[model samples]
Target chain A: MTAIGKVSLRDTVFQRGRSKERSKLLVFNHTVLLLLTAFAVIPLAVLLFNSLKTELDIGQNPLGPPRTIVIENFREAWEEGDFAITMRNSVIYVVATITAELVLGGLAAYALARKRPPGSDLLMLYFLVASTIPVWMYIVPLFVQMRMMKMLGTFHGLIIIYIAGNAPLTIFLLRSYMIDLPSELEDAARVDGANEFQVLTRIVLPLTKPGFLTVGLVVGLGVWNEYTLALTFIHDPNRFPVTTSFAKFVDRFDTNWALTSAGAIIILFPVMVLFLALQRQFIEGLAEGGIKT
Target chain B: MAVLTQQKPTTVIEKLSDEIWRKKFLRNVIIPWVFIAPLLIIHIFVVAIPAVQGVYMSMTDWGGINPNVNFIGLDNYHELLFEDKSFGKSLNNNIVWMLFFLTVPFILALFCASMLAQIKRGGMLYRSILFIPYVLASVVTTTIWKNLLNPKDGIVAASARALGIEGFEVAFLGRTDTALMSIAFIDNWHFWGFLMILFLAAMQAIPPVLYDAAKIDGANRWQEFRHVTLPGIRPIVLFMFMMVAIWSFLAFDYIWLITQGGPGGASEVIATQLYKNAFQRFEAGYAAAQGVVISIFAGFIIMIFVMLRRRGWDI
Candidate 1:
């Protein structure tokens, strides 16, 4: 759009007098960015700080650094809120749902991506339209159906819902991944006396482990963090996942800010660790998932 | 002659084996369908059939658990339109929430993203820190804010007391006037960071040459942002706007967790109202109608996007 010479254009970034002005601009940029960053970060830090404080200390210094560093809140929450059992339940849901979504959705995605089964276009359109169907539209009937089938208050029931909800995500992402893969090896395996099942398992699955991993992470995080369905379906306290249970736990211990913060941190700890460890992948996957929505 | 006949017999055996090996029943149809059936059946059971069932349920007066359903055509719709006060209020609140989200997050994200875009150093630090809130669960996010907004010991009250700012120590969530705004503020705190990331990515994708071009034209920072940044990121921004508007109707977790749409139905939204009707009130048919309405609102937004695309708006 500009006829300026390339070197001059590049030089414009720090042109003599402009360097001082640019530096000042950089300071302004950092100040605003840092302030906004603080707006995001401070609350989390306070959550963490409050989690480690005594109830008395928090009452005195609610939003500030804790006067006493106490680790007892975590123990109290685990004991009182039943984090031990809830965490296990959450893990089971996450694992079962992710596995179901990946295996089943992967098979379907492979069929649609490469095999192009009859009515693939129709199936694609179904998913395309279904993805936009608000969960509220169907959730009531789904609940009714689950109730009729005696599936309400079950982990498997919730997992089934999670898998169904994530199918579009799994199919779209995995299909794209399958499409990207050079299919020469799959063909070679087919020629080498392998069945379609063998080719997928021995070749496609292995080579596309990254894609499966991404799907697993995305779906796993979703199921783990899910609330509304878990709230609706799993009414029994014994089977409540971390999210639903922690919600009730927070409300029950509403006055106990320290215990509440600790419980919240416990719920967030694993996700935060995984997020920080694989931020790029997490961000990429979230962006991908968000884009689809 | 006998040897020739023997060869013909062997050839016939070979032909029979080949026919069995290439059965059309298994190749083009059965195997592919096998791969597809599981996902299709599960999806149909969970989403499709139920969604279809919801259309029927919307017309009936069936409590969720009741086996008997009385079909009353468009009655729920009639009541929703004419008689439902909470529904009307919830719908209005949803619109108000949508307006806040559409403006507040967009402004904050655009400002923060543009600022981050200008500087290279520590951008990742700022980006990741800013994004941390977004990754946290709604329960956790709301809990953090609930403490931060606590009337007595929370940040606002503490700060006011410290700074001698009189009459600023109001119980934000407890007051009907401030409850919805407070919840929106908390939700926005957890939300705007996400939009910032999206905007930042879009901004970064804008070719530097465009900025150089703008600079060459003697465009100021505001002018450059208006011309270059806005045009470059318009698609994502507008798409996100549409989504936020749709999502406003479906807002549940934060409000449900924080207030349960309480303090005089102040922050009640469509999804919350739907939940209450379906489960709490046992008005499944009414809830189904509400759900359909929420879907219609969402579908209308989607339809607008689709129509705009069809009209060659390029968004």
Candidate 2:
């Protein structure tokens, strides 16, 4: 009985020591994460702070919180940066690109995942190879082609390119998602006299809604944040998306810290909101899509 | 009339079977292609054809818009190889960018991701916060950093002055010496979190049993990471290394947005130089050559990794 008591006492001591070490490790991890969090967040906070500060206030306190909030920067930036038109254009591009990309990519993904037509493997291989081809490899010729086709400087033209650029990613992601789903339900729908298209619509679409959502969010964010293509294709100032337009705005108003800061915030606002709300989807989808693309 | 009527029944059976065969063929074969056609066609039109044409374009002296075009085979490549000083500088800068990304982000991300992987509580918050910068547009990210790094009245200057750090208030983005590295730093600030998140996800996917086994074997924290965590996440780590390496050559948006390869071409990467050549200088053929060179570099890197994988490196 005395030996048993001693062993139990020793066990408690070891357990306590282990717990202490674990907590120490946890504390260290938290500290590093906190510092990194500050590293990641502080610059953005500075931008936000500067956006709220007046010009004179920003000069005095560039990185600190504002002494007095100023609302004029937003108004000034909105007008001078042409946020009204550019943001609207970006919205149209994001929505249209996501819509078309989903429809086309979903159909293609469904076929690739389920139907597996003649030469489907070859088609898949083509996309896999094509997806790896960088935009730099083709941009110059694509520009010429766009010009020849009279698609340059047009919204639909840019949107079409966006859809095409995102197609491989959408197809791959949605195909992976669809492949996991049970084929039994689709078979049942087919047996119930549903044609292929009807089966896709009534059965497959409902089941694969999450996949679509993820693809849509990923593709839409890409379109919203796209820079190179928009800069190359859309030269018309009125047709410029928020990215290229904001780039030009910053160039013209480089010294106007408050105005530029506010413009930056405005451009980031929608994305920030969507990300905060659907962060799981955004993070997972982007992580997957980014790796593949 | 009686013999023709008897043959009609057999003909009906043959036609019915033929119809069934046709319907089965349509459902099984043609329909899927129909489904795949639209996006595939768009992709071909936008990417595949242009990519093919770019190779031929590289051999020509088509000055973007001029009706007169002539094939000057290999001249563009020859100039890029021997004569073009700017191209040399840009290619060298791309190498620098690649090396920086290959080292700094990998170390930072691997360390932080392993640290985060150890913590269960508040890991999500840290991840989401860290990833916020990645979600922002390149324009916004560059703007935020540019303002913060502004030599005059920017935070860095202000803080340097407050700390009495003399000569630390120089315009990082405006100077030739510091421009490329500085832009890389800014790009990294917006990028490393993404790598961290990727690493973190990979780390989380690693089996807990291997970690347990390492612990049972009396592995120290570093040993545990080295033996268990590292190998477990090797595939993702190696894949991302290749990707980051490829993307380094294609690095354009951040550099273009911030410096436009400026302060006297100190940060002139191939992509930015190619952009200027194609759009501004209207040397479309030369730009096409540059583009082809960039793609070849990317492809070569991919090939090396693939070759290693095929040779059973397990990477």
Candidate 3:
């Protein structure tokens, strides 16, 4: 019970005071976070909830729980809405475009990273500048070109366009990741009697696998969900992507909430799965690519 | 033995020169060209050729199908700038859209990200939930909201009435005054998630040591935020601002699908205008001119951003 004991007691009281303040802060933080979460999730919840309700129920009660589950809406949306075809087209478009983008984008990135060739810096600058220009600027001329070349309504044309359109960002991301790789690895490979091609194939490509995966997943997600270009270029129903097909539900019919909601749910499932499967890489890639760029 | 050794040295020099020539040919000439060829070919056909043709088409009166197009220089620009009344309104709407789209969400995202940074649990869940809207295509989002905002029996209207707000049953998407704003709000809801994720990522990039130092210096949360977090995310904020501005100018999908610039051309932005002019009205030349105008504006905004970035603004 000396001076040291008294000081320790005072410190304990001060800590209690700090704890109280922290508790108050914590409550405030939680309230704000809860509000944000609600704000973010309400629309999705509404979509899901309404999809389970009949049209009469949705119109009459609006926000109340469904009187009965209606799984028929999804069946209707799938068959009549041509969702099967749209899904097939979407898969084709995404796979073809993503594959092309990764190969071309990765090769270009590898060359630029290692060679430091003359005007390589200028090439990178060109991509940066090109990214800022709106794709709409080229839409009309592209349409005309496609029409003239008899490539309109062809999957090849759309795939090629998608690849070229997404190339700038893909290359930019891969190059940034490539720049961070250890130069010594390439030097060591060269010392081991590897040519430039061997260095790229055996060493650089293998090392940059993470970057490739990140770019592929990101680009795949974008192409899968793309709408406007698909709407514009792909007029044939057989070639329409998921977005265009879903849009048809709205265009042809009145406000059939059940079917539209079901379509939305179907459309959302893949993207959600994609994000869930690659959540870590996606988040990391987004952080790295976005902040740096 | 001396003569043979001397000859060996000369022969070795010749072989080395030949090897150098072959390596140089492969490395300096072929590889770079090979690496760049695919991209260059695609660019030339898809981007460069169309760009040139788009400019060419701007001078003509092509209806997008006819082979023959009468050259009509600057007439489309004249109509858009001077004669067309809706064009001016659309332009003004675009300005408002750009401002709100870039600023409000950005400020809100920053605030949310900052608040979330103080929390320990469920941060990733919140982030993923917010980002859900961004992953949905514009068509799906617009469709869902259109149904939700239905004037007569839509959930939003019903809910508003349930809360005792009179006249909340108004046809939000049908009227001119509210249509643009309503569309903008939906766009905000759809897009804010991405911005939140960006801000959150940028926030995480900030070192914890800065906050620790600020705390030791007797800074409270708000003060530390102002002194530390704001400065840390300034570059991202600036970059997002520029991007949002560009996106606003180019935005078409949601507006098109939701309202079709309708209730008589109320929510039309430049991109929508270009689309209507080209596809609906069959004014390909006029649309091309409008496209050029949009491109020039985009070019101006990008130039400013690039100049600022060069001056260390980080965008």
Candidate number with greatest lDDT: 2
RMSD of 1: 4.5
- Which portions of model 2 miss their true places by more than 4 Å? A1-14, B1-10
Whose lDDT is higher: candidate 1's or candidate 3's? 1
Per residue, candidate 2 scores C-alpha lDDT tens digits across B1-315 of 354335443587887876686688799888988999999999999999999999999999998998888999999999999999999999999999999999998999999998888765677889899999889899999999899888877778888999988887889999999999999999899889888888888888777767666766888889989998899899989999999999999999999999899989999999999999999999999999999999999999999999999999988
lDDT of each: 0.87, 0.90, 0.80
**Candidate 3 true-interface contact recovery:** 0.51
**Residue lDDT tens for model 1, A96-198:** 9988898899899888887886899999899988988889999999999998898888877888888889988889988888988887988898789888889
lDDT of 3 by residue, A71-103 (tens): 988888888888888898899999998888888
Which pairs of residues clash in candidate 3, taking residues 3 or more apart in a chain or in different chains?
A: none
> Sorted by TM-score, highest first, which candidate order results?
2, 1, 3
Q: Write the per-residue lDDT of candidate 2 for residues A1-293, one digit (tens) a residue.
A: 12323332443466576766776777898999999999899999999999999999987778889999998999999999999999999999999999999999999999999998889889888988888899999999999999999999999899989988999899999999899989999899888899999988898899899999999999999899999999999999999999999999999998889999999999999999999999999999989988888
In terms of TM-score, how similar is model 1 to the real structure?
0.94
Best to worst by lDDT, what's the order? 2, 1, 3
Question: What order do candidates take by DockQ, descending?
Answer: 1, 2, 3
